[model samples]
Target chain A: MDHGQIEATNLIDRYLTNRATPEECARFEEHFLDCPDCLSRLESTRGLIDGLKQQPPDTFQRRTWVGFMGWIAAAAVTTFAIFRPPPATPPPVTIPGPTLTARAGPVFTLATVRGAQADAPIVTVSGEFTLALDFEPAPGIKGFAVQVTSGTGEQLMSEVEHPLSASGTIGIGLRSQDLKPGLYRAVVVGKSVDGRELQRVIFPFRFQVP
Target chain B: MQSSGTGQSFASPRRSRQDLVSAIVSGDRSAEAELVDWFARGLAIILSRIVKDHQTVEDLRQDSFRIAIERLRSGALRDPDALPGFMAMIARNVAIEHLRQRTPGALSATAPDPTGGPSQYHDLARKQNAAIVRKILNELPQPRDRELLYRFYIADEEKETICERFGLSALHFNRVLHRARERFRELFEKRRSGGGIVPPLDAPDR
Candidate 1:
């Protein structure tokens, strides 16, 4: 039940993977309840195993293929539309005013790492941009709670129970005009159905308006 | 015994288990909350492993806490040092009882249904988690190491078999796992403090 025993037996991983005996399970659970370090390790190991379970063989390649096909299909449709013969009685073409395009500003995929180092990722954007926050959702989490704040502690956005996309990434659209160019952090918390906070990830980045 | 890779010691100064038990027996509401807060996550992790149904796991967790508190208040616990083991036992009993009820021809009228499917949110979460795992697997320096993890964790292959196939000694097997887990922990640290972030995908080369 001690930490040594737990490590020697890989008890945390075994317990999570359901490979432990009943006695081992009991001993490890009891030990972890009293040992915060073990408890945290148990949680992290559980997350890792649960995540691995969700992935089938070739999951990444399959998803990448699907994404690639989607882009190809979109491009084909665009090409067909552009090259198609003009309609016999086309309506008068009207010029549109200056407005935002369907696609937002530069899309930046922000990587959430261990901490804020001197070379923290920097995103140079103008007008509005999209921040893609990638995270490993814990098993059984129902929704994610996200909060964005400036380095100075100014709250920018707060959301509870935000629905996650199928890609395991959530895109946050922010206007560069509203944010001053310093440091900003986004905290994404995965919550269970009962609103329990299961896992949390922090993404820190510097915003530069060019 | 060593501190976790996160470098934050969870064994910081806190009320002893004996103090917690005595406070609870003395009708301290804060003590009750503290006890629940301390053990709730661990209990849930334990119970969820036994019970597949999310709702049932939740119900059993609450029931375990209630029963433990009741016993504590009634002077049932003999040794304050045995609090963790005692709570774990209570949770296991609750989960087992629920499982027994779920057995064919054993379910009572009041027994909660066990046939419910995972919610949509659960499915999405699984997909998201799978994506992250894929990223981690790709980051591994060796494909063989990735395969080792996949076989051990996802394939549920036996450790002995995996080690034999990989030609790794028992110590080496443990080392691979320990290293992978440490890397996983390093990337997965919650509320990480100051560190350098990777540049955006499209950022110009420095």
Candidate 2:
């Protein structure tokens, strides 16, 4: 076996024997977490503790029952405690009020959009971004949609999923790596599933890639 | 709950609630022992359902007994004859407390993959935290409330047990457990605040 494997085995040995220092045990657990074979062995070894037989309490204890009951009676009789219930507190009142500036429109003006760093680790590895939207949302435009595209016009975005109903939140985002270092155009569409009719607007925007 | 008190040496699935209670109160060591024995099995089953750390559960099983025995010795048991119920209560308090005391985050919670082994040290640490929390829980109310909840949750003991012990139905048991937990939470919060330690809550609720 390789030295690394041997080291792992020794760590496992320490763990099984319960001789491992806490730190060593933590290290061993971390090692086995990524190594499947060792994890299985650890599980099988730990299974033996399950076989313990269940037994009742002792006869000596039971023999103490009459005396025990006597003690309980004695304890209760002398413990003449009077607990008057405390007056209950009233529940808090919640007051809902109206807000002044509810939907004053698109605060996220395109201040500046940047591209990903060339050495960025694992771009496109995780998360969702809006592909296309016709325009910035107005009053109640439900959700906006954009036809995301590569400079080559190849579609690089998934079909627009409802942000509120399906995903619960609406966020505007873009991809950095998949596109060339120039702006490509796409139209945004706004739609809604709330059954309230929404105006759809599509807007074209520049795409940048680093 | 079947009485194990006959020539056949068999536990009856047909035992009445009173039969179980009577057996226990009669100083039948077997009754108390049965309660403890059954408690471990039932708790192991409930715990295994909620948590996958079998090793930790094993250790927890032993700790449950240790706690129950201590309670029994000190007369913390609400109803000594209702040992099974008492055992279950102790077990639940121990389990919940241990679960709470887990050091912050032991699991590497990055979207659990399909073919994965769980974190081992994390489990042990989590169990250790739980044990600590249970110690704190012991400091809250007497073992009876703890046992009542345990009988309700972990042991999944039938309402019949509750009926036999408390002379109340399942619904009353449910409400009682709920209130007991609330009381525990209240005590915990009080301790967290500047509120000084409340004496062991074993202040006996009739």
Candidate 3:
């Protein structure tokens, strides 16, 4: 390996092992971001280290729980095997996965929704109004996903990374005409840079038109 | 500090986990809530170590509980005492699944599928890999070296304690550890590449 590549590899090793100096760490991060070779080495090296560390020590040598762990693993596999349905079949009800509670209290109102539909309570009003959901932007999260779905789970509107207010909330103007009257659900999902869903919260509301 | 639904402390002391599991299994919603309340912070801490983002940690924290609850309700857990470990495994799996989904090619070929079916091949492969790792560790020749590695990485013992056990200065111990880890890495790579065994590189995003 060339001198620079060798040095980068060393830095990466130290970085992973927590032995890198701050200056070396900074340099390593900058170089790896632009260098795929270094990145791959870093990844593989991590894989090697983390892989070894994760194996239970007793399992490495002759130990008793080895069989027990195997049984548990088998049981886990069986559970998923039995519970998971075929790809073609859909579940009857989509239960919302457990999610983090939003940091702030609910702020937006369906006042316009209530006012416009008072005369004809069931029909959605045809107008625009501000819709805001309160939440704190979690650290390291690139963005949040905001989606509006019908009570029966039909997605109506979806947007990603809608900007968060300085006080940590999301505000979007909704046009009532775009929404039909009835119950609708609004969900916000926090996402990481790689687009993993982090925290999800739901707001159930009703829309009416007159 | 994240507060769960319960007005009580997130880390509030709980009844026996066995009892809690039984109650939850028997359809006690309040027991389930109490269990969720008890485990929320612990799960968050465990998840945050691997998953750096607060938002993701919170989400995974909830997922771990949900999955644990589901598994309990479905008779997936045969031993009640294994609940904590089971929950931990589920949380780790949830994080790994997230990583696998985002970058399918990034993971090694042998990585476990989040929703895969039961396979005897996977079991055999894991046992073989574990045996290989054990063989490599056994070849170290020095008991202290082996002990140092075990305490430092696996047991996650404190640095000072590890240093005292080895009669080495902190700086010396780190250097020793660096070399030890490098040796382990070399042996691991040799085995993995030669045997076509894939190493797991999946770390929850920080």
Top lDDT hit: 1
Residue lDDT tens for model 1, A87-204? 3332221212211111111334443321123224444443444565543333455567878899999999877346532224456657666888899887888776678876666677
After superposition, which runs of candidate 3 have C-alpha atoms over 4 Å from their true positions? A1-14, A17-27, A33-48, A57-210, B1-129, B155-161, B170-175, B191-195, B203-206
Q: Which scores greater on TM-score, model 1 or model 3?
A: 1
Per-residue lDDT tens digits for candidate 3, residues A9-47, read: 455545554345445544444333323345455644554
Model 2 residue A114 distance off true place after TM-score fit, in angstroms: 35
Q: Give the distance in Å from residue B142's predicted Cα in candidate 1 to where it truly belongs.
A: 2.4
User: Rank by DockQ, descending?
Assistant: 1, 3, 2
lDDT of 2 by residue, B1-206 (tens): 22222212223222333454456545556655654543444445333322334556666778877776555555565543344445555655675566556522211112122223435654343343333334433543443444343333222233465467545665665555435434434444455465543222111000
Better of 1 and 2 by TM-score: 1
What DockQ does predicted model 2 obtain? 0.01
Q: Residue A110: error of model 2 in Å?
A: 34
Error of 2 at A118 (Å): 19
- TM-score of chain A considered alone, across all candidate predictions: 0.46, 0.27, 0.39
lDDT of 1 by residue, B29-133 (tens): 888988888787778777776665556667888999999999999889989877878999998888777755555321111223334655565555455545555
CA lDDT scores, all candidates in order: 0.59, 0.36, 0.49
Best by TM-score: 1
lDDT of 3 by residue, B1-206 (tens): 12122223223535666677788889888888986865554454345434434456667778888888888888787876555556666765786666545443221212233333323544444445455545656665544555555444433334576687447787766665556556545665776778765433323211
Per-candidate DockQ vs. reference: 0.13, 0.01, 0.03
- Candidate 3 chain A, which ten residues in sequence have the lowest lDDT sum? A98-107
